[model samples]
Each structure stands twice: as structure tokens, then as C-alpha cells.
Target: MTSSLSWRLAFCFTLWLSQPLSLQAQETLADWRDVPVAQLEQGAQNGVADAQYALGLRLEKGRGLLQNFALAATWFTRAADQGHAAAQHRLGQYYFDGIGVETNAQAALNWLRKAAQAGDATYLYDLARVLETQPEGKPLAADLYQQAADLGHQEAAVSLAVLYQNGTGVAQDFARALQLYEGPAAAGQARAQNNLGLLYVRGNGVQQDYVRAAALFQAAADQGLALAMGNLATMYENGFGVPLDEALAVELHQLAARKNSAKTGNLHPGWVFDTRLAPPDSSAEALERLRQGVTRGDPLAGFLLGWHHLQKTETSQEEFRQAARLLRSSAEAGYPPAMANLGLMYFEGRALPQDYVLGYMWLVLAASAGQPEAPELAVVLSARMTQSQLVEAQELAVIKGGDQLANR
Candidate 1:
């Protein structure tokens, strides 16, 4: 049976075992009662691999049984001894995760290597993950990763590609990384597709192909990969992959922005959105979306709404107030762009009282988050402030806390 089916059966067995003794015997125990625990124990004792694996799972998870990690390990050992691929994989995970036993990375590696050698793709990828983070001077890690990648493990391919690209455990080779990513990306791995798209856009490994890059981005975006969505939106807006279609570009950006908002909530960071596409047909619609995003605690939407207002011929005090609140919320949540915007507001005395110290601090935080312009802005702002104020701002900037940006 498939592992999933086995898990389902195990779950059903657990539910059945929870009833009164008579009900358990009649409704559940009757079918399997003939297969006594003693019989299972005997079978496992006699080197029956399937019985050993089943009993191991039962003991490990306490399904229709008492949780006994020691028994689980013993059963796993028996099954693994009989060369059961799935059992070997489970044993590896148990060792690696230290579930029911002391953590043993080397033991995990050995079991996973056995499974990988048996053509288990999942085990191959798992093995690669372990090797990738091994301490420096371990020469075999990259080779093992490459072996797994050669076996058609998509994640392994990606990991190998990254190692090649960054010269981690391998010599730098952008061309090799690009080559490795192409097969998996073409086979519909979203991560591979996104990374390949980025490489294409940046012309790192191949000639820049905006059209191909957009197509790859679109494939990943269709799978709800937000980074791909944002990249594809940019291509549409800039007429890179397809003809410049402003309306379509805005639609894609809106979709990406909405997904970004939902996924990250108040932790939204300012990303490069291609607005070169057609302007919003209805500012009211944009405003509504922004308001919805803000209600959902999406800082990017709030910042965008603020920018929308500032670009208009007429500015409203209400807009500034809303922008200030949202920006402050985002800044507090560790979004550098929001912090930068808040700094600007303070510097100009537009929304709140002039507070150069606060402005400098926020700008410094923004700079720390990789905003290139923030440091320069901070410097200019600090020029008009006292030395003590600048020192305080510097201190505040270094106070690291929560996640400051969404994981890419």
C-alpha cells in the first residue's frame, strides 16, 4: 500500500481503538484481532520486513497503541535490516530529527544514502539537504547533491544550482547553475521556474531573454508564487515579454499585490511594481482595494494608497492621516519602505510634528533593510539634527527584533 493509504488505515485503527472494548472488538478489532499483537511481534522477531515496518509506525505514532519510541526504533532497525526503502527513509528522518532517539547526523546520512541508492527521489532530496549545510571542508557534500540532482530530484537540482551560483561547496559556475535549473523548470518546478526567470532577467547565465523570462515567470505565477507574479507583472508593464498592455499589467500587479498582502499581512515591504502599465481606470477602485488591504493589515497597500494621493493635483488631509497611520503600522512591523516613508513625513513636517531624531532613526532602519537611498537620506536629515539625536537614531537602528522583511 502507498504510505498515504497506510497512514489512513493507521488513523482508522486509532479511531476504532478509542471505543468501548465491546465496540472495539465488534467494529474494529474483529478484522485485525486474528493478526494479534503477539503475531506481529513474532513476525517482526522472525525478520518479516512488512510487519516490522507496520509495527514501527504503530509504535512511533501510538496509533491504536501506546507510544514507544524505543520499540519504534527496534522495529525500524529490523525493517531497515531487511532493506525496506520506506523503512530506511523513516529511520533516517527519526535519526535526523532526534524523534525517539538522540540526534545522529551521520546515521541519518547513512540511512538516507541507502534509500537514495535505491532510487527514492524524496530520500535523495533529503540527503542533499543534509549535505548542503555540512561544515566546510566536507568535500563529498556537493558531489552527493549533484548525484541527487542527476537522479532527477528537482529540489536537489535547485540546491545544487544555488551552490554553484554562490560558490558554496563548489566553484562558481553561473552557466552550470542555469543549465541545471532549466530541466526542472521546464518540468514545472515553481522554484526552478522562478530562479530561471530571475537569471534570464539578469542575464547571469544566458543571454537576456525577456520573452522567455516572462514565460517562465508566468508558469510559476500561475501556481501562486508571488515573486513570479510580481516579476511577470513587471514584464507586462514594461513590454518585455509581451506587448506593453497597461490595463493587463495593472491587473497582474493588483493580483500580485493582493496575494502579497494576504500572505504577509502587516509585514509587507515595498517591492518594485511596474506601474508603466495603464493607469488605473478608476481611482475609486484602487482606493477601495487599498482600503481593504489596509484593513487586512497590509502595509504595502497603505503606502501605495498614500503615494496615489500624493501624485494627485489635490491632496487631502484625510489621505495624509491614513497614510501616516498605515506607514507607522508598517514601520513598527519592520517594513523598511514604510519606515522610510515615515521618515520623509517627519522630515517635511507634513503629517506630524518635526522630529528629526525619529526621522533619522526610521531612515537608518530602512537603510539596514537594504534600501540603497535610505542611508543618503538619513545623512542629509542628520545634517540638520543634533549629534546626540543622530547617535540615538543609530542605536535604535541596530535593535534587531522580529522579521523585518517577508522571506523571498
Candidate 2:
């Protein structure tokens, strides 16, 4: 089962309760509640580390008991004294997060080190995160991350790989990153799989292996990793990984476009291939295709139609309105491109009254969704508007109802 913070704490408490030798074997929640708080205190006094830890958690969470941070800290200290790995980790987190404890980096590190030494992968990962943020030299952070990665911490592996790839905390070694990603990726880590695929696709750190790259991307895409889906779609369209299959390419692109739109609530612009891939009568065919897709509830199709309208030299008011409606719908659906496009329309007062606030908001959303061109577009739009207007646009962008408006 996936463990939430509460559940993890509960598990630690349960472990503590089970540690005392004198405690009855068949203890239940009822038994725990029936036991006088003083008797529980006596169990801790008897050097029952587990009891101490459980009593501490009960105090910390006020679970069937009173909330007392001081008591909780005392009990955790008792358990920590007994070398309880879970309690140590919990204490570390408490200190690190300043939850029921004074924030102390050194104290957190001390407890985390104990947990890490006891083979707690999660603690190791947390320790790495803390170390990485320290103003100290990069070598220490990289070493800590590597320790966590070696323990099969997936995020740590990905982080370490990225660091190596970019030479952040270590020397730039694309090969090392690729190697690191390979193991975790094979174990079904989505981010690792995505990175490995990218490496293969780019012929970086390894021989060009489009086939492997496509395979890895497919694995990640199957797990609903959106970026992987986009990359895979590109591979299909370009025949990089498999034979050129236009139908398959279109299908994958549609999936990527749909996911991208849904995730960001805006329609992404469709891929515009070079002149070589252009249809003989692309203008008519594209328009017809866009219409068909829109009829079928495809937001991407609507966005593409809007783009066509905007690009038209002899654009009509009707065209602009249609484009606005479609782009708005796609943007509401979290399509970054559509958000950016809609922002552009509002910024320029193309089809509607100029609304800087709404425009800025959409551009911000687009940028947040990792649109590479959003920043440049935002700068250009901001240049044409006043500071107050830009600020207002940002405020309006956060008002979430693009979906409802688009559906209308």
C-alpha cells in the first residue's frame, strides 16, 4: 500500500508497541486505550523502547490521546536511544520539517545518518535532499546523492543521473547518467526510462539506438508519462525508432496533444513538419481535418483551426471568433500552446477587447507547463502593455474556468 505521512507514523507506532517483551502478545487498539496513560508511562520507564516510541506518536498526533509535543519528543528520544531506525528517521524528519520540533539541520542529519546506516532507503533519499540544498561544496552533495542512489532510491537515481548529465554536482558524464538511468528504468522507473530513451534518441553516451529509445519511451508512455508520449509521437512521425507510419504517427501525436491539453488545460499547437512533409493541398486538407476533429470533441483540432485563422492575411471577424472559441476551449483543457495562443489574442485585442490580465495569466500557465517559447512570447506581449495591465492579466489568468468557457 502507498504510505502517506500519517500511515507511516502509525506504522512506526505499531512497531514500537510490539517491541516490549512484557507486553501482552494480543494487544489491540482497545487494549491500548484501556491501558492507563500512567501504565504506558511505566512501560517506557521499564526501558521498553517500542512502548516509548508508540507513546510518543500518540502524544504527537493526539491519536486517542492528548497532543503533547514535549512528551512526544521525549518518547522519540527514548526510542532513538534504543537504535530504532524508524524512530530515528521520524525524528530526523520532525527536525528537518520543524514539525513538533525546532528546525535543526545538524540534528536532522544526525538522525538521518543513523537511519541510513540501518539501510533505510527513504531516509537516505531524504538525507540526500537535505545535503543537496546546503550551501556547502557540490562534492559532498553528490556523494550523498550517490549513496542514496546506490540503495535503489529511484528519485535519487534520477537526480544523480541529471547532476552527472549536467555536471551540477559532479563532472559532466553523459555515459554515467545513461548507465544510472538504465538500471532504474529497467525496473520501471518512468523518469529514468524517459531519460534513457532521450539519451538513445540523441545518440548521447551510447551508440545511436532508436529502437531502444522507442522501446524505453513506450514503457514510460504506458505509465502515462506525458513527455515520453510526446517524444514517442515525434519518433513515430519521423520514423526514427520504427518504420515511418503516418497513421501511427498521427494517432500518437493526437494522444500526446490530448494529454498535453488535459494536463495544462490548453491545446498544444499541432506539429508543423517541414515543407517536405506538407500535403499537396495542405491548406484545404488541414482546415477540413481541423473541422472534423473539432466535431469529434478534439480540442487540438479546434486550436489548429484557430491558428489557421490567425495566420490568414485576409482574416475575418468570424474566423477570429471561431479561433478564439477553439483556443479558449483548448486552453481551458490545460493545453499550454492554446493558453499561449489565447493570451496572444487577448494581448493584441485580435478578436475581443484587449484584456492584459487574462493574457498574462494564460502566458504564465503556459510557461509553468514547460513551454520553451512562453517566456519569449510573454516578454513581447508585456512590451506592448503597461505594468498594471500585465499585473491584471496575471491575476485574471489564475481564475480557473477556461474549461466551462471553452465548452460553451
- Which candidate leads the pack in lDDT? 2
**Runs in model 1 with CA error above 4 Å?**
1-42, 58-74, 81-85, 114-122, 137-139, 230-408
TM-score, model 1 to reference: 0.46
The TM-score, computed over Cα atoms with residue i paired to residue i, of candidate 2 is: 0.45
Best by TM-score: 1
Q: Candidate 1 clashing pairs?
A: 246-278
lDDT of 2 by residue, 1-408 (tens): 112111000000112111232122123123444566688778878987767776776665434443344457777888887986666766876676554567788898899788767655556666666676667645676777788777667767887887787787788999999988888898998878888887887777999898998999899989987667767777776777677676776777688677755443243233221232233234677678878888897877766677777767788999889888988887777776787788777766778787767776677677655555665565445545544464455445435534334655
lDDT (Cα atoms) of all candidates against the true structure: 0.65, 0.66
Candidate 2: misplaced stretches above 4 Å?
Answer: 1-47, 54-78, 81-83, 102-104, 119-121, 148-156, 226-408
